[model samples]
Target: MTHGNTSWQEFGQTFVDQSRELNQKVTDEILERTERALVSAKEKIKQTEEVNEILKLRVEKAEQEARDVKALLSRPMREIAEISGDFQKAYEQQQQILANWILSQKAYRETAVQLGIAVGKTAEEVQDLVTQNANAVLENRTEHGNDSNTNPLVKEYASTILAIRKKNGEV
Candidate 1:
């Protein structure tokens, strides 16, 4: 009996030892896996920080470029406004000169007609004299090479009289 009891006690002791060894191995594996996970998490955080810094720098560069473009465009925009104002002034001056010239031409035509009528001639005769005088004026203008009386309106009026006379077989 004593021998059997000692053998059973030895078996029990071996089982306890094996169980402790297995528990220690499992604990070490769990610790190693946890350390690897921590290292991977730290690497991910570092990469994210680097990317954020690069994005910040790019944003700053874009803002600076936008400011530079605005500065460059300002001068041309001001010049365009100044040119538009100058053009308006020149256009107004030309318009006034044209208005005065038209008024003078109208007055001269009316005076010439009145004078012809007061010379004791029939209306038709006076008209013919006026036409002849206008033609002589045009000839003098062309001979003298004067451009002042060669405006489109003056040429149009002369051509109208010439056409009328030709149509009436009075040319």
Candidate 2:
């Protein structure tokens, strides 16, 4: 009876030790797998942050480029507007001069002989003189402007702008 009891106790101890070793192996495997998963998740998050920064820079660059393009496209319109303002100023000044001249008109005798005549022009050439002088004045005022009257690009741009303004009732 004593030998049988000793044999049973030995078997129970062996079983307990084997169960504890199996449980420890399983815990170690689970811990290793959990650490690997955490590292993978952190790597994915870092990659996402890098991609977001790159996209943000690209968007900023695109916005700046868009602003530059807008300024470039509107340059011709700004120049034309400045020229129109100059012409308007000249026209107003000419009108004021005409008003002053009309207030000082003199009735001359019908005998068409003038005592002094400048080379080929007479006092009756007011209309032609007005146009020629106005043009001379404008040319002098814009001495630094593009004065090539035969430049096709300048002519086309001006005509197009004027026509558009006319169509839009802004002329």
Candidate 3:
């Protein structure tokens, strides 16, 4: 009876140990699967956020394009064509005018520098004269009310030419 009791006690201990081992394995597997699911959910959220931002930009661009189309359609056909044709011609004329103006200004600046050197004046003095002339030209145009173009620089440069010609007794 003593030997049988000892064998029964050993069987009971083995059963308890097997149960504890099985519980640990199940718990570890459940934790690993839960972590994987959480990471997948976070990745999906990040993709959704990126897509949402692109959709907003697309909507803004579409709205702007619609406004532009509406404005174009509202204008008379003949007026639009004439405005476009005149714009092209004006742009070409503006380019030539700018080039000629730049060349003339270069010559004038060079002449002023030479005259300053001849008078034993410093380079800074020459530059000051040029700046003063430019400012005076801009101010004179504002006073005359003879503005034709929208660009202030064009008006100022034209004024400068007139001012220079007047100063030299040519105007």
30 in model 1: Cα distance from truth in Å?
1.2
Model 1, 18-136: lDDT tens digits are 88999899999999998999999899899999999999999999999899767655665445445567655766677789899899988877777777678876667766865666566
Clashing pairs in 2: none
Which sections of candidate 1 miss by over 4 Å?
1-8, 77-171
lDDT of all predictions: 0.72, 0.62, 0.74
Question: What residue pairs clash in candidate 3, if any at all?
Answer: none
Better of 1 and 2 by TM-score: 2
Kindly list the per-residue Cα lDDT of model 2 for residues 54-103, writing each as its tens digit: 99999999999999867755676445445567655766676688777665
For each candidate, give its TM-score against the true structure. 0.39, 0.41, 0.40
Residue pairs of candidate 1 with colliding backbone atoms? none
Over 4 Å off, model 3: 1-6, 78-171
Tell me how far candidate 3 lies from the true structure as C-alpha RMSD in angstroms. 16.5
Worst 10 residues of 1 by lDDT: 139-148
Model 3 lDDT, full chain set: 0.74
Clashes (N, CA, C under 3 Å) per candidate: 0, 0, 0
